[model samples]
Target: MSASVANPNPNKSFEVVQPPSDSVTSLSFSPKGNYLVATSWDNQVRCWEITTTGATLSSVPKASTNHDQPVLCSTWKDDGTTVFSGGCDKQVKMWPLMAGGQATTVAMHDAPIKEVAWIPQMNVLVTGSWDKTLKYWDLRQSNPVHTQQLPERCYAMSVNHPLMVVGTTDRNFIVFNLQNPQTEFKRITSPLKYQTRCVAAFPDQQGFLVGSIEGRVGVHHLDDSQQSKNFTFKCHREGNEIYSVNALNFHPVHHTFVTSGSDGAFHFWDKDSKQRLKAMSRCSQPIPCSTFNNDGSIFAYSVCYDWSKGAENHNPATAKTYIFLHVPQESEVKAKPRAGTSGRK
Candidate 1:
């Protein structure tokens, strides 16, 4: 078991595993919880296997494939036999996992796909793109089964409670009811002066967590009939822009949460106290996205530089991918300390 600390300092020490050079733009873990997939500005998607015997720092990727443009987002299928990615070239592609540990492209999108997600129970795929539209595709259909348009550019999104919540550059969130195709259920306004970068909903779909560029996170209750806000908190210090906020599956199970930001830092918070328990800076470049493993034992993140370099020349040498292993706390370490000085005979 990994070691744990009591009210651990926000800067508690943890292990970091670095992947091959590449500016990581997006990250997702496999459904089976054995691997992690990362997309980078190098137009490549790489997968790494998770192991508990201490990460092999110099190990190469288990699989890697090229895209036409910078891959902005990716996700794995429910069966873990395929991976999907969206890129800057206005395309969404599917890759099938072969028995020999190789991936082959199988499908493509019409526009630059910004995000992709697979619904396990419905056996459907959903995608959001710069075309200002959200499309739902049936695995068996050749064309999109449904599409929804948004008023502004979409940055990030998530689906919960059969509803799609989309974050936009305009600092607003739109909730679309999947059951009722024609209904626009709610338009959530952020309490920030800047755009909303990311949004995540609780596993139970009872509440949601929204991250803003102004470095704040708002927790809201989901209620269709009432328009009341439950509570909100300043998750980060005043100046650091919260690039992303992802609720780990472990957090719900362990009552803890984590957040990443442009400041190149990751913070762990306890739900009960709403206090920051741990913090660590993983990269010098900005972290665009991050997600926890299915088992909640590990998480992955991607780092890419700001506008100093040209987009086409964004090589893997300049980009980096990081995986953090959660060190479990020991019962003795978490136990209360006794009072008295050793010299008091």
Candidate 2:
């Protein structure tokens, strides 16, 4: 049994009151903090308002909307008043949160939309589809503002201001400088040998992290001169059993990042020091998605079947979905000193 499940600590961590009824595909915290939006295979997009009083935390359901099919991804607008969600229905819907109005279709794709992101800098919403194309939507217009093709089906994507990294099927990594939203900044093959599972850009926009199905993560720097600093590391493996790395999220404040895997474990790592900062006890089920709050004070993760093993392996009677919130100590997320330096030991 996982330590967290065995010993529930209300002060350090707590489970939200109500969670998605099905597999949670993605999680997005409001840029303004206090709100969290989750998209799930149940075809529902739900919002919750997070509140804290002393050591106790609670979540109040704010609003919920649905899609025609499983919602794959979601993102919040910079002002915190709107949310954009996409799904297997191949449609992207924009929700005006404050107004409590019905969602409207703002974008469409030829196939399932795998990822949806709000490019605040460009004031546009970008969607990546399994149709192997990326489309930027202006919202006001009837058509996409711009569309860029990918090498294969879109699997995962991460954006930080001007930097956007898209991981597609066939191990293709497409990088984009959002400043030049219409063109691809560069394209490269994934450093990891297995299929890409998730990708996250570094907080500084210097590079990005890519996780693969073989339980490994590749740290790649965009600049040629920094290529030598790039490397891949193994994680989430227990002896001979290797599981896919399902999610990667960078700390908004500390810059160190965390990786969740199909093995039901998550670990924080400092890329610069080449060391693991902290590793949480494994859960009973896979963690399909996770994210940090705006200020990085809390980490939210969903515990559920990832569907990687196919529908045959999923037992509805036995499966239970949960969303947990963990508050990390400063030492747990802050970067440690590099080798040869005396520090927090």
Candidate 3:
């Protein structure tokens, strides 16, 4: 039994973490699997140590670093020595975990930085922005090494080492090979009608997942021969109320992905079998972001007024923003086996 599930709180289900003063835009677990980092509209990126063997959550962050504007995204480098954060200030900062956890601007985006991804093989970082461009940074330098212009602002992105895919505001599915960053890429039409809100690369790197605000998801395959395997489904919807699919994170080894939504619900799905293995009870408000640690034992997610069109209407109880920590059982994180006919996602 996982520590969290082994010792349950009679008064609540999951452990709640309260630190950020505003909406949390993104959450990531360190590669070391001992901490959870969050970027928020509070204009700060905060880190919290995980008590893997216990259920209590620390009310304070291990480190909190500020940005000029609301930070939208964050991720840890392959080693835990550094953390990269991006914000509405259009700046990307590298925060050294040592040295009092101070930050230094390493690069700048022409617009708010919506996402940051590190390419370990090339030892570079790529950022997407509302400026309709993706900038590649060497990290050791101050200026971008290369830039790729997009047709519209980037809304979501997913990367699998050599293969990268980004979803733009106009629903253009832009795919590229990072080994040759400037190589001409494939641009496919997104199958969803609403803006793409989140994406996740498949375990095999053969294709990726695309999610939209209309409570729908597209399972995409890269090759024409696998077109029949590509399909779309509806989720994040309840009766007549449609909710945005706020985020998606795949378990590091299981390929069972989790989805958080504006409905404040979290679901675990086996992408290969297309079966929902679990669903968390409805939370107070929307959950903007969620992530699994590299080992897939700890799950962290944020529930808040996600700045969606009708966010202000959420009740005060639900308006209280929070990051919840869940220590899932290994069995719960494992992907379920289906009949032999079930195929890859």
Where is the poorest 10-residue window by lDDT in model 3? Answer: 2-11
Worst 10 residues of 1 by lDDT: 1-10
List the candidates' TM-scores in order: 0.78, 0.95, 0.91
Error of 1 at 267 (Å): 0.7
lDDT ranking from best to worst? 2, 3, 1
Those runs of model 1 whose alpha carbons end farther than 4 Å from true positions after fitting are 1-20, 54-60, 98-111, 224-229, 238-252, 281-283, 303-345
Q: CA lDDT of 122 in candidate 1?
A: 66
Residue-level lDDT of model 1, residues 284-338, one tens digit each, is 5555666776755555554455333367745555344444444434221122223
Task: Tell me the deviation in Å of residue 213 in model 3.
Answer: 0.2
Clashing pairs in 3: none
Q: Write down the lDDT of every candidate, Cα atoms only.
A: 0.63, 0.89, 0.81
Order of models, best TM-score first: 2, 3, 1
Q: Model 3 over residues 126-198: C-alpha lDDT tens digits? A: 9999999999999768889899899999888888978899889999989988778876468988978888999
Clashing pairs in 2: none
Candidate 3 regions with alpha-carbon error over 4 angstroms: 1-13, 54-60, 310-318, 340-345
Displacement of residue 277 (Cα, Å) in model 1 is 2.9
lDDT of 2 by residue, 31-105 (tens): 897798999999999999989888767899999999999999999999999999999999999999867989999
